[model samples]
Target: MRENTRIDWHARVEQALARVFASLDEPLAWQTLAGELHASPWHFHRCFRQLTGETVKQCLRRLRLERAAFQAAHGEARITDIALEAGFETLEAFLKAFRRAHGISPGGVRKLGAWAGTIAAPSNLHYAPGEPRKHFFIADKGDAHMDVKITTLSPLKLVCYRNFGEYWNLPGTWQKLFELMASQGVAMPAPTGMTVFHDHFDEVPMPDKRSDAAVYVPQDIELVEGLFRYETPGGLYAVKPHFGSCEEIGTTWDKWREEWLPTSGWQLDKTRPSLEWYQGHFDFAPPELHVTLLCDAVCRA
Candidate 1:
């Protein structure tokens, strides 16, 4: 089952790569790619990220930069044209991304032909002119099963408010979300509070890291600007109960990703943001008594 699932995703990803290569010069949305590939946007993004260890955005940016490097090496086009054809909205953005990724500017590449093709990649994938190459990973599935559970999550209509800055420093955000809900006279089905991480913590810039504090409400509840509605798609998720000091939550997550996930018969579903689902009023609960259900999106192997 694991092999078959990976094979299916491998083929689908190759199709996506071909599409991306053909349209390098065009502005493409990750969602659009999912549509063209006949997949749900979330599922497609998740599969691509899991398989390549790169977000769809990251892969696109890398490919554009690689293409730019190729053009510069040939000395066949101006940097402006190269940037535009690479689908970068601005040359400054292109230059910044290129310099950061390759440790050299396009000009530098053209001058010395030092296109760093060895940009670190788990799948070892890079730019190819016509169609990209096939890439997949094979790992032995270990038999160690921890006390984690696989469960189905129903679709959710969430009223969320965005919070930026340090992810862990969000007591005020949750406070605001609940207060706004009260001001709007919204009554939730339960007193559940959820925090959804919109970006990977380590990969995203600290200043731009984003999360949403949300509460589940029925569809009939009206939404205000302070609280917006987001629908979480129904799917399989791996649920692990967390107890004790919230400060140590990071350690638990590390163990899951580094120790359990790689060997589990499930792969991360990238389409959904990781969630911390809280049951009791955390603001009032003692640190030792606080309980959180750490939910990670998952697909069967």
Candidate 2:
């Protein structure tokens, strides 16, 4: 059954790639690509990346520049016309991107009669003969049994306490936020709590990591001194229910990033923050706890 699932995923991804290449002259939409594979946009994105080693956006941009480079090297047509045909909005934008990728201007390429060879040639899933399959599977670490879905979330107004520092210190911040909320008389029946991570640890220093411990509350709730209101931007997310000790949740995230993400055809949506959705009570000690991790998946400009 696992093998069959893997095969189906690969076939669907290949089909989606074909569709994307067919319409290279136009703007590519995640929704359209997801629909083609009958998969969620986040899932499709991860899978595409896993199969191709490039995000959909990256693949499209590379293909366009390669086409433009070819024209610049071998054709006499005006650069503006070629840029427009390659889906660039303007000649200037095309030249900037081309120079960045190839280390040479279109005019330089034409005059020199050769491309700088810095930019790799465009490639598709169907490689030349003797090429090996790029996708591979990792040993399932029970996370494969976890259910994941791409969902659109409505904007949520949160009563929050912000924290800045190392991630391990977040628990203390949560305690402070909870105390502040209680003191402010901002209480909710069956309250849903979340911890929002605002910075990627890999991209930022430990001292710069920012997190917020928040709870959904009435929109009109007045803020107390240390507490403030935050509106989580509504967009698509990939959510997974986690059942484990809060401390072990980081392991699950690692599994997703190292094991699942590469093959999932999705990339982390860095524009928006990721959050930990608290479903119910969690005993920090032993056994395991049930919570949900909401990861940003929508790509925005």
| TM-score of every candidate relative to the true structure | 0.48, 0.49
lDDT of 1 by residue, 31-141 (tens): 998998899999999888777666777777777777777788866799998988877779998889777666567876676553333343445456755553645342223
Residue pair clashes in candidate 1: 46-270
Q: Candidate 2 — which residues are off by over 4 angstroms?
A: 1-146, 188-190, 283-289
Count of backbone collisions within predicted model 2: 10
lDDT of 1: 0.72
lDDT of 2 at 95: 84
lDDT of each: 0.72, 0.66
Give the poorly placed runs of model 1, Cα more than 4 Å off: 1-145, 187-190, 283-285
lDDT of 2 by residue, 2-82 (tens): 678767876886676666666668888867889866788888887666655567787777767766776787779899998
Candidate 1 weakest ten by summed lDDT? 134-143
